[model samples]
Target: MRNSTALALAALLAGAGLTGGCGGASAPGHQGTPPKTGSSDINPQPRDSLRKGGTLRLSIQQWITQYNIGQVDGLQGDGASILTLTEPKLWFADDNGVPAANPEVLVSAEVGTSGGAQVVTYKLNPKATWSDATPITWQDFATQWKTRNGSDDRFQLSGTTGYDDIANVERGADERTVKVTFKQPYADWQTLFDPLLPGSAVDTPEKFNTGWIEKIPVWGGPWKIGSADKTSQTITMVPNESYWGTRPLLDSIVFRALDSTAITEAYLNNEIDQAPGRQPEAYRRLAGAANTVMRTGGRWDETQLTLGHAGPLADVRVRQAVTNAVDRAAIAAAQSAGLPFKVNTLGSHFFMPSQDGYRDNSGDEGRFDLERAKRLLDEAGWKASADGKTRTRDGAALKLVYVVNGNGSTDLPQLVQNMLGQAGITVELRKVPGNDYFTKYVNVGAFDLASFRQVDNVFPSLLYPVYRTGGDQNYGGVATPEIDKLIDQAGAETDRAKAAELLNRADALLWQAGHSVPLFQTPQISAVRPGLANFGAFGLRSERQYVDVGWTR
Candidate 1:
């Protein structure tokens, strides 16, 4: 559970078009060649080229609200990115989002069936310890499990699907081992327990939610929080001397809060070593910088328009009309304009085009057919005004509130507004502060339609929160029993082929219902210092081995 909260947070920021190029793959036409890893390649470098001591400087869109990412208010992209260096996951997801075991923390994780129930036994590495030298034990696991299982609402967790499904968590012989028996089978079992918090951090609701808001006392990975400055909006981390795994290459890592618009300037000024280059304008500006390389590739992140089921968008026909009225291709082209690679319009809400089991469920809904859109709106009781500038239904104009983060360029939303205006829909664009974008607008359902990109996990089963009825992240209020059934069926499946089939079927329902419009899969574009190695966007791996990130001197 590598900060599951951060996963959604990253998606939220990506959706807002802030850091669209953060995860997975280089941009379409990378100009430079990456160093090849031959048989003589070092563990984390090419031969003896890695330099071990330097401060890695990075930038983020906003300051983290809380240190604990599991809490609703604390779940954020900045915090999650920082935690990646401080936390230990049972497994790390590859660039393609596939989960793989991490032997640094886990000796082995065995999954089996006992009495028709699913069972997982995790054996911890004997040397695993916190920064304070406390042994990582089963008690820590039980503490986190009890706080986040959803049985108790005081902890304010982001999601509890997996934890709630567990029948029991018991110690296996000694503190070094534990067994988790699931009341129901969870096919994505490998996705759990990145690192369990010490008992002090999760022993109670108050401790779980507010204890780490200012400082995270517990540390279990290669790096521990060194210093956090609220005034300067920076957090510095240093290597955890007690780490049992191979020592990290960098002496320290510093994450600073900077406006998304200033990232390119910062990189140019040498204030930061690397920054995402998803924005076409920024990529163009940094394309010829000295000692820098721009890498790009397709990312799992996607931008889309989410309809609020309670407003004028309540009618499925109205949602369909809105989806059809917008020209998705134009929006994608505008975002990718001047870039070296061609951008494709994304069609599936569940899987990217490059991923397996992807299907173009967009069908006619994704096509820009103003005539069809008008027909659908007219059928939904909205009639165009005499001047043909707007639609009126029962004496009220078909007006919509479009909410987005205020930090990035408004070109995309403005383009969407113009396209929908042709269909007689009036859009009022609301630019909220970037820090408050998720809590004030997205989570509160304060907008009639919201636009943001979402980052997805490798396992489709992990997507239940966005589509499942009454799920924590289901801000669209999409409640369909049939879709829920398919999600459940897919999660219960042990066969990968069958799970993909069921998930696609559920995704089809999402498309037809006009729950959301799938947009383009943003490419991961970033400019890094020439000698910087083992960092930045990758195609097959999502998680970064910070221990391996260094400079080739």
Candidate 2:
């Protein structure tokens, strides 16, 4: 199981309310030698009439969970991908998923304390404007802060442990200058700076504060929402001519829903350009085909096992037993041919080990051992049931419902269920639609166990929502005062050394407590057509989207 903070974030982001409208911008001529876009470097190409009007089909197993930017809780990475196709954040990660010091939309971003609240300052790009020709300004940031930071559902700042210190936000006398003041010192302030919301979108501060989450969002990105097929399963986007950044290469992009088997077939038949959620080896098989190219996926993107935080699961012995009972090496092999890395620790309060704070605890606490698992359960006062397939205490059977994305491979949970069975644990595998599945089942803490996956970013973005107690994303029904303290400090921590120390300590604590069972870190490798030059970051957050990419000869 992953940590509680990430689960909370997923639940909230699943319902984000964002609206987009884009037009064409002036194109820059091509410049650099033709190179893969998803590679480490941002190869700049000069402006020209891009290979326009070719339909790029994308098959992402599930539909986008939510449209709201601030309210979105769980699917932050997926939301980021969608925004890249339709909007621009003040500070976005470069092609490498590292936060760009200055993006095209915002000139600079810095965090500080103001009146006992964490304050974030944003300087807007003079050329940046919404699709409707509204210039992005400080008023927009202030209004977004007022609306999202003020709401109960909004997970952007104050409500989340990452931003618990943010007190308020205000605009400077100049429209381009804005400030966000926090309630306490937060370490993860950068999480809110990206994909900024527009002021024009929030005309009624009351509406936003009152849960009118359906409001159409105003966006400033390369593409705009062209045709939303609420009836069918397709969503079409066209290049926004008024975009402040480089003119988009493609005329239109389509996001279509397809079954897993059909997605692979579509890629082979040239019906789609790409598909997300395919296993690493499966993606490897299709890469470098006649019309396709494949690349390696990144860290901290894959399936996870979440132990319930409360009720029967709150027991440390139960959590430890579950962790040791499953063989992650086998699970990783089943998912990929040893391509995915085994993670034995409860995910660092944040998802990625590459981030500033990460500690491996799998060696000591998360080792796979059915005998030890049985011993732990026995010590916890559980004995075999009459059927010998389950453990019972005081006549109550140790039963768990394991939830996972039904559209993906069934082998993921089946392997886990089989492993747990060896320890006499009865796990009921429940497969559901990936779209908003986290929100429906995990968010409400409705299930006993859940197969989880989250796209991790630079640092602390997914922390508060996943770990903090009562966190909207805390679907695991679990929390610890120590974990909470470490995560909260990590959010406000500005110094790299201190933040890393706190996060490492927190990761160790989680493993000791058996809060989550570490699975493998999934890769972002995928197949792409040869002509597609810029693939962007190859993970969950930055997938095979065409936002910061184009064709080059």
Candidate 3:
């Protein structure tokens, strides 16, 4: 249930990130904790055993104005709940983080070599067709690779990770077959082509960047666009009648975008059948709701503080001081309060403690040491004021802006503010609308500090785009040479074990770099109707698809 690499790291980091923690309460006497090895809690129920039909209502923390997940502005909320229903993933992962090809889109996925270069061969499901009735083909695969390959700068992407490692993507024996040659033997090749885009959506830079803005121009999964009302900030997905796989039982699924507090209210008011129990209010309200069941699972996710590169944090020592000042234990305790689950503070950038490759690479940077924080500031030329309440250097107060999206726990930022204040640093809490959180804030380097969660994947390389310099998700603005080398070598890594070591070494540097500080594994807590099947806190199952999600009588 828990898992690494630049050779393998890219795959590991690739399928992850961007968010507010999803947390909640378990039933009385229920311990929502993961086994030491980690696990998922989706309340599995076979398709045939489920009820024939029912609408599933869900409250989502984020609504995508830019619907193309590969694009620069493409981050969705935790679990990407909307993407699961409306998009296509060629593969799916079980609780142990092992990948399996999705028969709905891929017949078989095999790894081998071509001219000594690692290659992956994919056979498309013959029955797989786009919403427009066009057959899903190798061209779609090729185009997706090309657009995200990082060759053209016009196409602002969230990641060039696995795509950039490819040597080429060509057709195989048939139009339905795809052959992708990698420049090196990257680990977890299955992480590629996730929510695979149609060529029409990615064939050109202009289309790839803006085509899906405020709209889903294409559909490739069990569902198609029913309506996306911007005014209401809700998306309605209906079953795709042309889908080749087993027909989805639900007539429609509606994802309503709401803040954490509103989501809790909606759940308690019975306006939404399923809601994220991340908000404390939700946990309290749903704790006694007869029809609601609390679901918690272990995940390859962590809530972190990303220090913006510009401003006072530009100095590495200042960043390190900030990291040293944070009491992750206290924050974790607060976030997990009133819940049976045990949420521990995270220590590595690449792996969760419950995962196999995990190591406490954080070292001294991860420790709470106010004295060391003061020393680091002093060494960085920041001096405490005569009053000793705040630091100042070069006519600038040692102040940092902490941006909050208003969708996550308010306690986190406040805690941060109070903790930093003790270290003679002034932290200003700036609240932003959830909609503009990333595009207008995190992505633009608009704040000195920010809080968010990353939902990780089996393929740790998915994190490449997150930690590298100018990485799409690198809001922290801290990328070290060693980290870069590991990222470069990740695609070249053939040995998973060695690759994991390489990732840990890089994470050590990540701690040393101090651009980002790991908080706790963002708790995945959900409140779902008892009848809901195959839907809940999906731990490390990043490769999951929504076809099997339905009601169990």
Candidate 4:
């Protein structure tokens, strides 16, 4: 099947990416070669009717270090652990990535702006219960907000720029109802309610602020944590029989940790049923087997080498020279294994392209040009120093330290380094564990370059923390009044095209300023075995949880 798809794609490439003679006499088009789009071959098993009883074994690259839903800092590739087994949100978005009007836990939720209250109200389903069997009520909702706000701790939802929009939340006259008020006209109200924690666990909002409360293990989601071993890298989750909605089809789910090579080997040997974030080559090998391969929309992280406007990098011409020097297309092509859609240093459309504000500025950023880069360096007062390998300005060599979360995608920094080397810049790569890397180092501005990933599913407002000035979470210290203004407008502009226009303007500015290097809009891909049911619910690349899955024996 892989061979056939490659052949078909090869046939299709003849007519595309070619505009006749301008690409030089020895152009790739003249070679009559077709481009690769990752692995073109995948034969997914036909959908099978739902059946139960088989244990679904999965070999994930990462382990579930913490079980707490709200406190777990990183998505950690263990999102299934958070969303499926341990906790439930007010509502889950549909396949289209839009918030659903009706959710399993809540009958309906509404935010009323008419009243001075500026409240977001939710009506809970009476049947819902914590894994411990306590009734989930509006009080729980109120407690969730208070605890998140008061905690001032790691997982404080209120402190997060996204959730800070809420003014306060209160219980309605009836215990089943909850009302929340926002301090400002901002989006992300959905995010506040979605990571709902149990209200019964605490007596006061202050007590809940401690991040450790998550270990107590109260849940309203479909499954409950039955057993887990942090050292052994295994976790077992059992269905919550008393769940308000449809019960999970599997009796239990076991997560086993394996490195990249080990995971692909295990899946090919049929030791595991599924795996996400495998290498592109691994997917290519698996495409021939009687299994299904799919892409998920999100990634673990990204790395950007930013110029400090207040420091030596204050010159706009220097920034442009840096931007023009590196070749994004070459980096993309190499990183993608010759796939046609390799993307390099993308602008501020940081969120996945599916979101309303995503604008593609690949052409505007300009492709790799060694000659142009040399010219820019000369113009910026950076002359080739005694060492041909390095560039110097004001007697200071352009030496940068690039850092990355030890557990993140390895392809990012490597590609950036290669591109920079071609443009005469020296970069030193540093790796740190995921925990200390983001909190102590990246957040506090310890590194010159880093790659991190942020998944914002609800709306465009997710950009506030990453893009705005003085944003607590802004790792690169990138602040642009133009970007902030456009993000603000894009968030409020309900009209699609207008919002895109505003977003594109912001994207161009980001590229022009050299704050971020636009990467590709990654596709959401997933690989599944035959007879796996309801697996597509895992959402693009299995980012979303699979509420329903069973086998067709």
**How would you encode candidate 1's per-residue C-alpha lDDT over 1-553 as one tens digit per residue?**
1123433102322322333232322344432222111101112355257887999998877777777766766556567667767866677665456666788888888998899899988898898887767888887777777877888988887667677778888899789998899988888877556545677667888888888786787888888889989899898989988788978889998988887798899999999998776777887677656756665545566677888887788899998898899898888878767565546677777777767777787777767799999999999999998887899988998999889788667888899899999999999999989878877888767888888766645566556877888777777786689999998888878888888889888888887788888777766667777677776655446444588788888
What's the CA error at residue 410 for candidate 1, in Å?
1.1
Tens digits of per-residue lDDT for model 3 on 1-553?
Answer: 0111100001111122211122332344454553333465677787789887778787667666776777777766432446555667787777777777888888998899878989899998898887777888999989988888889888888778888889999999999999999987878688788768788777888888888777777787888779889789778888878777877877787878787768778887888987765545566566556676676667676777888877778898999999999999998878767655657788888788768888888899879999999999999999998876799888888889899987766788999999999899999899999778878988777899998776655567878777888777776678877789987786568787888888888888888888688898766667777777887777766424466788876
- Candidate 2 per-residue C-alpha lDDT over 98-163 given as tens digits, one digit per residue, 9 for 90 to 100: 665446777777766555555677777888888678788877765655555545443332243333
Q: Give all TM-scores, in the order shown.
A: 0.91, 0.82, 0.92, 0.78
Ranking by lDDT: 3, 1, 2, 4
Candidate 3 Cα misplacement greater than 4 A, ranges: 1-38, 78-80, 279-281, 542-544
RMSD of model 1 against the true structure: 5.6
| C-alpha lDDT score of every prediction, in listed order | 0.74, 0.59, 0.75, 0.55
RMSD of 2: 9.1
Tell me model 2's lDDT, rounded to 2 decimals: 0.59
Q: For candidate 3, what is the lDDT?
A: 0.75
What order do candidates take by TM-score, descending? 3, 1, 2, 4
| Worst ten in a row by lDDT for model 3 | 1-10
**Weakest lDDT window of 10 consecutive positions for candidate 4:** 1-10
